[model samples]
Target chain A: MQDQVRSNVVEILTQAIPSLESKDSFALAALSDRAIELAAVFHDEDALGIALVTYAFGKLVSRGGEEKPLAPMILLLQTAVNALSSDDNSAYKKSIQRLTRHIQMVDNKINLYFQEILEKARIKKGSKLFESGFSIAAVASLLGISQWELARYVGNTTVQETQPLHTLSVGKRLKIARGLFT
Target chain B: MKTLVFDSGPIISLTGNNLLWILEPLRDAFHGTFLIPRSVYYEIVEHPLVMKRFKFEAYQVRQQLEIGVLTLIDDAKVAKLGDELLLLANNIFSSRGQPLRICQRGEMEALAVSILKNASAVVMDERITRTVVEQPASLQKILRHRFHNAISMNATAAQKIVTTCKNISIIRSVELATIAYERGLLDKYLSRKSSAEERSSLLDSVLWAVKLHGAAVSEDEINEILRIEK
Candidate 1:
């Protein structure tokens, strides 16, 4: 959450986390985590998810010489949210819906972003894959893909067969999803 | 001009764009030889999660592929770290660098190569995990998107990568997308089209990834770019 909250996160989630908490059973990790506790109160998963996404707003920013600082905790927070969204146990329904929306928005923005950089990394006229001698791995990473996936999806990649993507158990799924999205 | 080292994230994004065909052209197009340290090959190819994709690509570039550097892992620890390292990691501390406690050879080599070459850039999406590793001062360089895309999808940097990749060469965009269509990559892309909501969700991920990473285009963006080119 942005610093503007002003309220004590521990106090707020103390009330909110327990709302879903069973007196006899509880998440020690969650209870112990100050971030979780503060976030637990807003328990409206969707709103909190939105607040976390405020980070991805900048695509590219370059000035004379200052290097960019890491984006605020928002990206890390979203990754955690993504991990949780697929977990049925930890997932609140509202959160998943919100998360799905966020991914869509991010997807929409990636293209514009890529076009911007290709412009900067423009190659000398008439270079081709065979000539560059750059490994496929380098190209794949430049594009934000796993080498395996890159080999599979790229044309004439000579990539192997597609293995089915295994489904995650509900609780585990939500945990992972939460890590990624919210 | 800085040199970039490729990692796994950009590869996955390409499958979505149907741009794998471009690999052939790309492999032929660039001037400097790109690298995929041997350790990187093992992490992405040997691991159960990434293996299928790895094997598929291995066969394609089998003729051209060359080992850049072998990741020096604590042989003893590699066995122990096994699955944990595969899930995703920034760095693993191995007080017990005994046999069976392996760390990612891929990560080590990638870093080592950067340092050895006094290279200025490293392109790794997964490195910003809970831990970090020490490196020679020469190894440090500007992360390609460090200035733009990574922090957020809304930055000016993010906008540029997307637009430029969209226009890379109208002719190549189609050829690349078609190749992706022939492969199962299109299936994964279409399956999500089940709903606009799903489509949008996937799209945002592309936008953010492109901004942070380089011009690694997404399936949706490739499709859109090709359609525009057509």
Candidate 2:
């Protein structure tokens, strides 16, 4: 029954972040239901879990109109998302057991779609960082890629071959270096 | 004149360690032109200036360019060679179904420039590039371990790479920095109150930091450089 709810919520989800709160609860409810199905389509379980966690957190915001401690929720959701993505069903079940610890973390209303958008943004930033000549390991750590999956995405792209624009002139640099040294 | 080609890593290492001042003196002492490929200039000079954190280092390099201690060459001049080398190098490492791109375009351009100019050496700090150019067997072994299989290149292509790499000497920034220190170029910037041991330790720390930052110098190699009797 819970599986049904998880897979039914966000079937029609397609909007980006920034204007998430004004989005009606019907949409949020839909996201919560279709989380698993969305995960399969995007091949990303963690992001959908992030979206769901944020949805729950968003609910508290709408009710009190104040910021709440969402860190614990974020952590729990991340674990659950990873569990879902795992091939082992026993591991997924074991991970979901820890979710009970965050039962009182937030109220029922969540800004679910907002969290999904945030996850997508993080992935985007990860690719950009990799492209900028940062080591693959460093970027992978930052993006929380579990199995060198980021490499496959990044390896396909080639480095941009253009001259970067210089903001500071040579004279200014010499002056600065001299001033700093002197 | 004999030439020495530079990649972006060593230059960035020098700047990051507050040792850009040594370049001019080193260039003045060496009897060869210091060549910087366009891609390298883009990496070390143009890219850094736009970002606030690296603007100062970028400027320091610009000063070197302004003073003619470093000369920029169009990458187009060696683009054909660079691309060929890049393709060959990647193919050599593509032991598994997946291809490994060990060197960036900038690094390839530097290698191209080194070959075209008949450079005395290519001062670079990237481990894979250094290994491929100077020690192909080591690179092949590494690729074998990475792919968990035997890696091989066609005899003709292997011969071609070996022939091209023979004329190119690969040195790390640690060596260049050591050379600069030995020639007393760093004395003006560093304090005189320190003992020789302290100076050596300071140099090791700076070189180690550069090694960590991305230059290919291994910990063992760094230790060897430090233990050298000057």
Q: Per-residue alpha-carbon lDDT of model 1 for B1-230, expressed as tens digits?
A: 22234444343344334333444434333333445455554544445244553465444333234332212222334333322332222112111121111123354354444444443333343222101222111111111111111211122322332232221111112222333333333446557346655544444443433322323233444445334323
User: DockQ of all candidates, in order?
Assistant: 0.04, 0.04
lDDT of 2 at A18: 20
Per-residue lDDT, model 2, residue B7, is 82
lDDT of 2 by residue, A21-117 (tens): 3434445444543442233223244444444443443444444433243444345445554544444446554544444334332344433433443
Candidate 1 DockQ, CA atoms: 0.04
lDDT score, candidate 2, position B222: 61
Candidate 2 chain B lDDT trough over 10 residues, lowest sum? B93-102
Provide C-alpha RMSD values for all models, in order. 21.4, 14.2
What are the TM values for chain B, all candidates?
Answer: 0.36, 0.88
TM-score of chain A of each: 0.19, 0.30
RMSD (CA, Å), candidate 2 to true, equals 14.2
lDDT of 2 at A166: 18
Overall local distance difference test of candidate 1: 0.31
TM-score of 2: 0.57
